[model samples]
Target: MSVGKRAEPDPYSLPVPGLVRRVRRIAGISQRELARAARISHGVIGRIEKGTSMPTLPVLERILGVAGLGIVVVNDEGRVIRPMLDRADAHDGADRRYPSHLDTILDPEPGEWWGDIYGLARPPETFHRDRSRRDMQRRRSQWEVRVARHRHEPPPPKVPDYY
Candidate 1:
């Protein structure tokens, strides 16, 4: 029996060196930091950024993961190439929105894969998130206090006892 070999990815569809750099910038991390986080050598990261080296699939995934990103394959028509699994059933209400696919033939990355939601593609800064959460909690507690106070009031003075 003979087995078929899997086809290699098209060179044209692979992400460009600049895409990695841009994502790293957006992630607000230095090249060394990304290397440290991904547990890869900084020299490898530098070469990858410089277009002097091409990262293997695993290396690319590791770097992207550290930047809070992932890769996806898309057809020429810009449609995603993944299997259509029922997102609702799979995630059980854990965020069912899909990422937007941009048509940028000139871009190094042929397809865009957004794992995060609109307006929240990148994780927010920790301090900012903490502040916002505390404000929301305070507002909620205030609302609850008002509700409790109203519930315990003296029934509006018994409606004047004559009207």
Candidate 2:
């Protein structure tokens, strides 16, 4: 059978929900109890375990923390990978008071590239609003086109003979 242009699913994605479930079980907690401890809803835990929703990094951290575990992105050989957290701590000197170069780059300065490209360098609200608006617009446009096509197409005439 022919299929549309869908990407092949990755095997790695299958383990995440199971891992979360195992961790919660190991901690001897029910889904509702874990959700309460994690400051999220039981439905969120159910959704995460069912692979219907993808939690953000911070939310994942909180969930894992509540289960007496923490997220550790690792390679196939089990090497710990801390890309974002390490980058966030790269420039911490003995004083430990100064911000890293990333902060400067990310700050909404007059000459920053992010500001030039996005109109505001570090306003997360802008990114969130833009993403939601674009998604809604795309869905609306697709529905409109479908409705227009249906309106133009005529139904088949009633058949007099039956096989």
Clashes of each: 0, 0
lDDT per residue, candidate 2, 1-163, as tens digits? 1225767767447566886798698888988998898889999989999998877778888888876787667765999976644444333335242332223222323432335455553432111123333344545555566886656655433322211
TM-score of 1: 0.43
- Show where candidate 2 strays beyond 4 Å: 1-14, 82-163
The CA root-mean-square deviation of candidate 2, after full C-alpha superposition on the true structure, stands at: 20.0
TM-score of each: 0.43, 0.42
Checking candidate 1 for backbone clashes, the offending pairs are none
TM-score of 2: 0.42
How far residue 63's Cα lies from its native spot in candidate 1, in Å, is 0.9
Best candidate per lDDT, number? 2
